[model samples]
Target: MENARSGNAGKHKTRASIVEVAARLLHEQGTAAVTTRAVAQAAGMQAPTIYRFFEDKDALLDAVAQHVFTTYVAGKRLVEDSDDPVADLRAGWDAHIGFGLANAALFGLLTDPNRGTRSPAAAAGLEILRARVRRIAAIGRLRVTERRAVELIHAAGTGAVLTLLSSPPQDRDLGLADAMYEAVMRQILTDAPALPADGTTAATVAFRAIAPKLPMLTDAERTLLSEWLNRAGDDPASFDASHRRG
Candidate 1:
């Protein structure tokens, strides 16, 4: 048992070492420089040894992405949440942009169409975003359902990063991200009015936040109510007409 435990630990260390070496190479030299031979040489291991841990270059890149993402998320977790949810959300947006800009290669690998959502790190980041959006809804400030708000914010943030990354650093518009955030905020949040102009929408948003917790309803019933609430939030008049018909 002791020998087997030692072997497992050694294997884990070797895998981590290879991933760390590949991550550094990807950061400094971009994805094209992360060949198995290059990573093995950097880690002081044979090329075949890398294959023992990773099946192919794609797998190695995935490991590198996971390593970079874990490091980034660890830093984010150390930062305490702000009392003001909106402020917290803004901080998250800035952090995300900084992470993407600083780790361009890893960001590119994580955002690749084939590998993007499949990354556990990417899913963790989305969960963080969702939590932030939920905080806003809990405060009765969100004008849309929590899910919709999360989607809008995620789409805007991803688009902003890709847009800025596409431009040369010297020519990139630093303000674009802030502007996009503001645009999404306008679309998804209520103003400082005592009551939103669209009361049904605000009610829908608020109710959708707690819809899942209603013990009176089954899962399917809650789902149907959530769908109705979403439709109401989007178009109260249409939702009302549909209900009247029903």
Candidate 2:
């Protein structure tokens, strides 16, 4: 029985490996390149085995997309105990941009029509962000209309990061992404009361504003973003121009 169990685990791993490899290839090359026969050859598994895991090319692609997005949200840092909302929020946005810019291909894959299903990963991000927003809303700093803030924040961040990733070296800079994020946060928080006199709570408010829209993540691209967090809001190409990158 133990041997049988081990065999099952091994089979699961092999299937997972195939999914990961196929997702990468599709992201890097495109769906046409990831034929069942090619995946079988690459994974060193038979084509028949691939069929056992996925019904057809479309099924495989859907699974890959779900896996990629799910992985991206699982890695986010949603602060629970922090007193400084603003700084925390900025940190969260920076992390999001870093994740998206570094893994733009995965972002493309997850957002692609062929792969846009909301998996556990995308839902997880929304859940985390929603929780944080609820906390901030409790503070009276966030207005009722501010509920829409989360969507706006994500749109801004995703748009900015996509720009930075696609721009030329002379035009590309992650700092620009940070700036764009900050501008949006300030606009959102402009009407709110000043934070705690000590400033930590106010900072926390700022943090909460940006925390929900953390980054564009997909399981296909797992590398986390560190540099983008530290620099914080340096837009070289300018906020307007960064949005124009193809």
Candidate 3:
């Protein structure tokens, strides 16, 4: 049992060491410098030993991306959530832009179309964004559906990072990310003081946030009401008439 425990600990340490070496190479020399041979040499291990922990270069890159992503997320999670969901969302956007710029190589690897769908780290980040959007909806501030808001924020943040990264540091427009966030927010959120004219939309969004917890409604009733609420989001007049008839 002692020998078995020792072997497992050694394997875990070696795996972490390889990932750390690859991450450093990626940061200093970009993706091309993160080859299996270079990483093995940097980590003081044989090339085949890298394969024992990772199936290929792609797998190693995935591990490096996850490490960077997880580290960034841990730092972000340290900041407590604010009472103002909009402010929280803005903070999240800034953090994402900062992460991408600071870890350009890792960001590029994580955003690669070939690996993004398979990246657990990327999905975890999106889940955090979703939670933020849900909070906005609960506060009756969101104008669009939660899914739409999430997509818009994600796309805007990704586009802002890639745009900034493409330019020389001195030439980059630092305000571009803030502008993008504002543009997306305009489309996804109700204006403060949320006019009575837009009350139906705001009410629908707020109720949709708690639709599942409606104790007076049966499962089937809740599902049916949800469909109508979704439709109401598109055509308030028609939904009002249908509700009157019911």
Instruction: Please report, in order, the local distance difference test score of every candidate based on alpha carbons.
Output: 0.86, 0.64, 0.87
**What TM-score does candidate 3 get on C-alpha atoms?**
0.92
lDDT of 1 by residue, 1-246 (tens): 999999999999999999999989998999999999999999998999999999999999988888889778778778888899889999999999988888888888887878887888788888888888877886678877777889999889888998999998999998999999999999988874216455677766777776777899988888889778878878988888888998
What lDDT would candidate 3 get against the real structure? 0.87
Order of models, best lDDT first: 3, 1, 2
Residues 1-246 of candidate 2 have per-residue lDDT tens digits of 999999999988988998998887876776677799988888887899999889998788777877876676666642454775555566677777777766666677555544554555665766666665555644535432344667777778778877886886577876788688767766565356545453333444444445445576543322222222111223313422433542
Consecutive 10-residue window with the lowest summed lDDT within model 2? 224-233
Q: Worst lDDT window (10 residues) for model 1?
A: 192-201
What tens digits encode model 3's per-residue C-alpha lDDT throughout 1-246?
999999999999999999999999999999999999999999998999999999999889889988888887777768899999889998899889998999888888888888777887788888888988888988888887788889999999999999999999999998999899889989999876245477587778777887887789988898899889887777777888898998
Number of clashes in every candidate structure?
A: 0, 21, 0
Candidate with the greatest lDDT versus the true structure: 3
In order, what is each prediction's RMSD in angstroms? 2.5, 14.4, 1.9
Candidate 3 positional error at 42, Å: 1.0
Residue 134 lDDT (model 2): 52
In model 1, which residue pairs have backbone atoms overlapping below 3 Å?
none
